[model samples]
Target chain A: MALENVALEHVPSGYGVYVGFFRDVTNADFLHQQLLSRNRDFEYAFIDASSVISRLHLLSAVYSALNTLLVGALRTPNVHSEIVTSFNTNNNIADAYRRWGITPGKTKDLIVVKIISPTAEGQNGFSATSARTPEAIWAHLTEHVMGKPVPVTDSEIAQATDWPKVRKYYRLNGVPALEKVADKAEHQRKMEQLAIMGMALRGL
Target chain B: MAVPHQQQHQFPLPQILTHPSSSPALLITQGAEGRLYKTTHLFPDRPCALKYRPSKPYRHPILDARLTKARIAAEAKVLERCWREGVPVPAVYAMDAANGWLMMEWIEGVPVRQAINEYLGSGESQEGQEEAEELGDLMRRIGRVVGALHKTGVVHGDLTTSNMMLRRQEGEQKGVLGGEVVLIDFGLAMQSMSDEDRAVDLYVLERAFASTHPRAEKLFGMILEEYGKSFKKATSVLTKLEDVRMRGRKRSMLG
Candidate 1:
């Protein structure tokens, strides 16, 4: 099969893929061979930039929509964590552009594909989609896929309790762990309430 | 910086009164805060004053530490500020805020109130009539210093002659002539722009004069007139002073 026709699956969404184009098959082969000789795992293909662009086009559209959604979600009150995750994911996509050699003045066209994976703890499951460009990848993540729920760690539970010692003990570095510890502490603290209830029940 | 001259005194408490090896001066002043001692420079033989803020039992340890640190810092800052403004106050030598003590220059003179009283009452032994005339000039200088202090926005909350020092210049041929008036003890000084506070300062001094020195009214009048010349803002204060004198600082039922 031709390199342009080859498709790799399971790439995470919001991640950028770079495809370098050569003028002819011989030139492309020569470049690929040279890269392979220097280092292991060198992979290249003969394809026009337009072919890669077509494949990523749908992915780009989805990313753009997702980016808009994420921005809106961030603007909402108390969605700071969502905003941070979105921004960080977008930054990763931008870095992919640099890796592809897609310069402003370069005559060679390079295609970048972005793959965004819903976070593991997020309610939505993983979905693979192609992005034609970096911007398109951003849109897909923000518009289509709902944000994944962040995992709660022990440290987060400790922090929420405002008991620094307990938080430190759990080694939880995020909000969820702190919340967990606070909930546990609060439940344990309800012993007083239970005692009061028992006293009222005894009188009844 | 010039290493101040060393002064020596024989003190009973070695820890409280440390003698610089060069000078044998003993520092001896006791207060609620701590004990103070006078000493001389170890190398230069210049006079220096030492203040030791003692620990208080009434205050919690943390609060005492905070208070001692703040008081020492404030006192040092006030002295430096006053010195920069050409106020004849003591130059700080060393400070131990944690210990609640500050060491400054040991003023080599009698307290102004003591000098004034000695001259006005005894007038026989110290320097004869010449000394009495000199006391007049010294009193006027005291007034000028007070005016200067007020002009600089510093209200010496407790303005008493005992807080003023009349230092005779060292090695002078003439006896007790050309004495410099120095102000001391800034434990309660606060920065203010209020004329009322300034007036109250003058009133305190006036009362101090009446109670301490004989025929103080006449002498204080001379000081007041000189003070008026020193500060153009003194007129209104002097006017209010007359009213204060009448009211006697006690509220009447008529009000």
Candidate 2:
């Protein structure tokens, strides 16, 4: 019921981006299994919420993946998987999966991102009407994923963040630009900037 | 045979910009290598500048792709390096090097060139004690930013007042020269540790500063004075700048 229909700037209107967050997820294994089995119904980016920094950070990855899909330059099997890969600061896809992807037990909090674009629906051989509405997607997620649904907001995302893991993943430890910042909010802002920059300059 | 004048002058939007958005992407400027668009990044509230490099019709497809990709990647890399070192520059938002487009944070305020001209043109007399001090401060900020850039082992190949933006400070009064000096246009930037490269960068800025702000050319020394104090190796770079100034931007014209 907490699934939010997110609207990204510059993204085509036909592309529907729906996001949902869950805390203390109990059925991560089942969701992980569905992803591994390539279940058509489970075509969502199941991200470990702990590794994410904030709403902006999550949206940036989604934007990058969506852009890749638009340009027909997807490196992963699908745009869902590409979202996870876009979080990486390098080209190693497996590393990205291990770091940001949902694990069976380690992923306590979960962020599910469903991108319903024209290409995805057409390629999946589903008519526009039959290709999963936001309500249908929410119904399916609530019935399957066992967790406490939370609004996908910055405050909620901040609670689930593991700073140590994020620092290691984004290489934000002891950065001179960050070290010099004395204010807490400014520090976090700079960290987010650096992390986004890391993702933008990936493979370069 | 008669296409409307407005339609005739309008260039085709890049493939990315063809997508629907909250607002229409406005073409800000067109350069020889690329075009800049004032657009949004991820959210409509976050405005960003999107630089798009269109493919050249003259070059072979393969070579053109390679050159475009390499240049975009190089510029992004240099921008990232400068950002990490705390150099006042626009943070890159997103990029598709292969697609020849880079999105960066939109800096607010006028170009340094425009700011200087406005200050100088305010009064008929050349010398105003208060205005001179304000201009001196702006020059120091520019020098410090350039020095910090060099310390990070990057050389901005093109250094001009037009390439630098005067970002307004938070809660600061509008139309004042006091603000952060953010360098932009890294299309020709590169990573280098050589004194010659650093000196050449300074020399280019000096030449550009003189031409752009001829009335305030005497204030150029304030920039160098701040540059010398910005880093440890700045003195040596300044010494090398004299040699560069004598022979001009070219060492020996082999090209």
Candidate 3:
């Protein structure tokens, strides 16, 4: 379950995704250091889970990154990093990474995303089957990440969400219709819709 | 789907669509001016309506680009305005004027035309007084939506039943048209403050009703009555509508 990824039918054929939700992450500092050191092996996106609202919120970012990759319109360095930045409303690359990406002592609950796509001929030094196997990917993640891997479900995701931060990040306070929904669950659903739509229309 | 205007001589595609996947923009309409496609804006989870004004082969390149850019920009601006003013319309999600594509929120529902036809076909008259009152309620909702739109200082240039949708409510039974009214297809919409423009909007809708649902045409007055209660300016707009109807939607040049 940890290594096996979901394949979106509408996406280009080459890409596969592996996702995990972790409750207690203690090695964020080490992970951050690896990213800073440009360790090619540590290319997974380590999202600060508290900032994430739901599975859709996280997947929306993935969708944007993959769409950008398919068209070669990537705004960040790579598809992995772009998912980290896609949550923010604008294109301030550094701001998005700092706000949503992992921090050394600050992040506890964490969401990990690994995107494995076929590299073009003679590009990036990857062979045709480099990222196709789930076993190798799962073993590597388990060895590196210091947390118990869990399924990406709404109930689990909700436990990690910081509502105030999510609201401010998505500018939900400014929307009148959103403010009018009195039901708590209904309000959350509306907020998710608005947030996803907000990301889709980013830079517009 | 109609043949995409983007044929072999397709102009270079927009930078927004990075992947060269075979045209995933599913064509939804082939109107006189442009084609509408249902596609994702930035991700597969997000479904959006992409309206593309294909460069006309009959016109020069420069002229075609100018017109397409202007139309997309204009339509985008109007949609934004309607959304900000809380009018029930599809939100403008994204736009690439230079590429002639405008992405909008994909609204879900049946077109009011189909809903009305089904209601009338169901022999609404025999369904008791409750059905008739419910139909009136739906008409008033439409009137209120249009009133809100006009109050925002814009005019829907082409007012037709097909352009308005009746969003089916959750767990709603079939053939019972009730829910919010969402106005769509703002390609011809433009900024206008004139009572004449507002009146003409009503006249066109009235004509649409007369042509398609003559039996339901009697309920047209209920729409006006409700519109007058929507906004302060609605009274004058409804009054102008009567004058416009009397003149058959044309003013004499003799004056």
Number of the top-ranking candidate, with TM-score as the measure: 2
The prediction achieving the highest lDDT against the true structure is 2
- Please, what is the whole-model Cα lDDT of each candidate in the order they appear? 0.49, 0.89, 0.78
Ten residues in sequence with the least summed lDDT for candidate 3 chain B: B9-18
lDDT of 3 by residue, A1-204 (tens): 565476653465677788877778889999899888867777788899998988877887886677666656677777878899888877788888888899999888888888877666325422343334677767777887898787888898898888898888888777765666689998787677677656755554
Candidate 2's displacement at residue B41, Å, is 0.7
Please give the interface root mean square deviation for model 2, in Å.
Answer: 1.0
Docking class of 2: medium
Error of 2 at A91 (Å): 1.2
Clashing pairs in 3: A70-B18, A70-B19, A71-B18, A71-B19
lDDT digits (tens) for residues A1-204 of candidate 1: 001211222122343333222221223333334333532112211122322212222222222223334333222111211221221212343332222222233213322222233343221322223343435543532333222212122232222232332223222234221233357644433321222111111111
- Candidate 1's docking class is incorrect
TM-score of chain B of each: 0.81, 0.93, 0.88
Candidate order (DockQ):
2, 3, 1
